[model samples]
Target: MTQAPEDAIDVDEPLAPKFVAATHDATGEQVPTRDLSELAPPARPARRWTPKRVVITPDALDHPHAHRIVERVEARGIEVERLRANRLTGVRGATERETYALAKSTMAIVVSPPSRRKLQPIAPSADWRVDLAEGCPAHCQYCYLAGSLSGPPVTRVYADLDDILGGLEPYLGQGTITSRRADRAQEGTTFEASCYTDPLALEHLTGSWTRAVEFFGQWEAPVQLRWTTKYDDVAGFVGLPHAGRTRVRFSVNCLPVSQRMEGGTSTVPDRLAGLRRLALDGYPVGLTMAPLMPLDGWREHYGHLLDLVEAAVDGVPDLDLTAELITHRFTPGSKEVLLGWYPGTRLDMDESRRTTKRGKFGSTKYVYPEDVMTEMRTWFTDELARRLPELHVLYWT
Candidate 1:
């Protein structure tokens, strides 16, 4: 439950010696049992965002990114409104629940002042956190951003990305990785962009993240742009000249967990296939196994999850594979807000069954009991090591 660094692990260098492909079964009958495309899940159908209304502030009215966002959404017949005083309004609902729902589906275009965009350290993940956006459109039942963001949680994409990328130069080569060993693949200062939002989810509407990706692709520095997404919209940025400086980590979980909690997002197989697709393009890719719940038959579920991941990147020799293990933890405020957002959610957050721990800011949270945590951590660490020996487990919490 402690919102601090947990079991930071030291994984061996990330590089598979070679892929053992099934070229032939027995008699030299020309046959390859499985192809890369066959191993992955089929093409994912597009996810249509429901942010029908977009609000642009005066500061962003003249921004190119704002214009692009307007052009894209307007092409789809979504309304675009301009805010005069830099405040969003006019999204009402019949009740509190409906109000939350309405706000979640709205988009905002605003310029993040240089002062307000001061970079902050997000240890264990990256040297610093850089946000191209400030809210996510996904409706995960155990929504972590529920109580975190102020206002009505409308997805806000910053149009001042040039200024934001211009600010990262001062913090290079001073970050703490998972460890000197597990993170040898990314030997530089890292900047995580999806701490507060999923960039891919907003990439289609606002080209801010596309610009961010291009900026990192061309920048000459010892910095890696890191971000994770549950969405599988990768075609736009996959062909960019990232130069191995940007690591795209896909957030995945067992099918049971994702289907039960994660809503309006790509399926787990689709996300895994996205990772595979990026790896094939020679970009650094990672797997983030998050909100790990010890559900009934968890072993079977996670085993299948690992099998899918193995199928995802097994043939890519010399691959840069990273995994971030995150067990589910929640705060009282987040619980209250999520309950209001999803009153019938079956997520297990019973205080009596959880252990209490305090965070760096002295905020209390409830995490799984110590015994349960041990069981999950042990099984995952051992299984990951045995199954995918070359993968680096960045951390487990």
Candidate 2:
């Protein structure tokens, strides 16, 4: 079929832009001149974390707390970029290697609604979840966020503190079925604040956790705020009038596991020292021995870790201490993502050694074998009883 002449198209029909070209005035040669800017995605600002680079969404750029956050972060010589929310989706690498690297180190800042409802329940520790931030800056090899969140884990702090703290009022008297314990005489709503991020890692920049501790302190209701962290910056939290409403649980692993798998986290001693400090200052403290890998001689190493914990809280009379034991488990998807994120990880994720089991969330997970699980349960329970008899074991999973 013959092509229609450019100027002979019907009035209601428009000619294809690609078929028409503007003529150069001087040479009379066809030249293509079309504006494609509207069709292209908006540019995203560069994302970096340490030697920090921060990107804020346009809607949040002018927020009062956003300004304060930017000011504080910039005060430490960090670079902040203000961009629109849509621009964030365009952040990606054209090449394979660059994309992989970008997903590992990029961080962005945006305003998100505070946890107003139980989006998903965080059982065992808290019934409902609260989030001060959405990502961790720590580069732990086995970080679960690697699988849960899309792209590289970028630490994002929401700017609306008033709304976030205000949202907790409705859940004041609510309690999860397993939240109550007779040892503490505490019974009320429980909120897990560090479900997706490490508050202490962002404390210097956002001070969200500090404010949360204070918020829980003066709350009229008997609500309890709980958070866990691998970091040890407890100085700001120690003096808060938490009223035993806030439980600061420090995540500790045997030295060998931490040194091998955890990156950019506080040293074991520093964390224990911080734990001791908080306990001494009348704060309820706990220890989280997570991802309990049954490495060779794990019992000896973990036993020594228990001994260290005992020493840290040794003299703190009437310490309201608790323990959460989590064994090493991985999903197939998580295993793939984690290996991609940290190709050099020494984590023992070999599926052949793990037993397949269905998780509470309907996801499949590879857990330690039954015999090994029994041994671990026996060892840990016995160790807690023998070394730290006063400490409460919340659950073993």
Candidate 3:
């Protein structure tokens, strides 16, 4: 592999740029309103994810949250059944692919206890990750959580969430967000919520994320709750008293790649529309252009993406936009799991097209070669700076 050029975008590099159109009062001072009706987007199509099966653990049978979830599911004419306390009764199929698909469409309601062990650190995203749920139901071909979780791939939403949020009290004022450098003195602590699952996907059934949002809204701390989603389910979240404490980033990519690789999720335009709505409501918003595949005609592909983003968010007042850029990389175990799940997928997981890169815990994954990475990252960072002057790139990895 050749060495990257000196101008290549480095991982975890922080860049803050601003591009707000100025409006002056008679006194020569800038005055702005949070009105976004001028740049309001059209209605975007919504995703309808009805799980094929709903299983409840014995302990969750009488839980309040579980009862509400069951009522919601049953209201839609779906019946629920009970499972053994610590067992998945029937989640198997004849072939590996069939089993994988079945598990994806199944939802398991369980009572998960708070971890007595230390919480996991999610660097470059947040200080500590506190998972409210464990799995996602979206069938994206590039599902990196493929082999990462234990047990079957059933989507599990915890019933014991009060304990989970309660456990974070001791961890505040002591995370990477505030202690990193002199400039981060104000951001007391940060927690990443979507480390293992997309919150919006499960928010509909469980209403657990809505609860978490309320908890963060009332807490009188300098804490920030961060989570990005591929879905545009914000109806349950809007109009909440958030106190500027939550940042919702939308995971997006070029059209061809998103249509081909990501199924059962909102389209790029729809996600941008959602981002516009949330930003209009005064929630700090971000664009998470992740698993960046330098496909054919790569420049035009992502250039169009930047154009859409600019049009969607050009006029919102007091906009605090940030970007998290993540290039595509996959481990061998994930590759195998994905192959079994979607044997006919057209995803580019070829070993020849990627080079080996070592990750945490001595794990190695295949990533684009240095020259390719340098070219793509350089163009993206430069284009983002040129288009959205007020955007801050939190990190690139």
- The top-ranked prediction according to lDDT is 3
Query: Candidate 3's residue-wise lDDT over 272-299, tens digit each?
Result: 8778877876678898898899888989
Instruction: State, as a TM-score between 0 and 1, how close model 3 is to the true structure.
Output: 0.87
Q: Estimate each model's TM-score.
A: 0.86, 0.82, 0.87
Q: In TM-score terms, which candidate is top?
A: 3
- In the range 187-228, model 1's lDDT, one tens digit per residue, is 477888998898778776776777776677677766678899
Total clashing pairs in model 3: 6
How many clashes show up in model 2?
Answer: 1
Per-candidate count of clashing residue pairs (backbone under 3 Å):
0, 1, 6
Give me the overall lDDT of model 1. Answer: 0.76
What's the TM for model 2? 0.82
Return the lDDT, model 2, position 249. Answer: 89
lDDT of 2 by residue, 1-397 (tens): 1323424422113212222112222222224334332322222221123523567788676557777777766655567776746256534578544555554454566667433333456776676788767888787888878678765555678776656787778765455533454643364678889888887777767768888887887786667788898876665564456766778889999988898888878877778776776665566778888979888998899988988887777666457899999998888888988887778888889989999999778998899999999999999999899888788888888
Q: Quantify all predictions' global Cα lDDT against the true fold.
A: 0.76, 0.70, 0.77
The CA lDDT at 304 in model 1 is 97
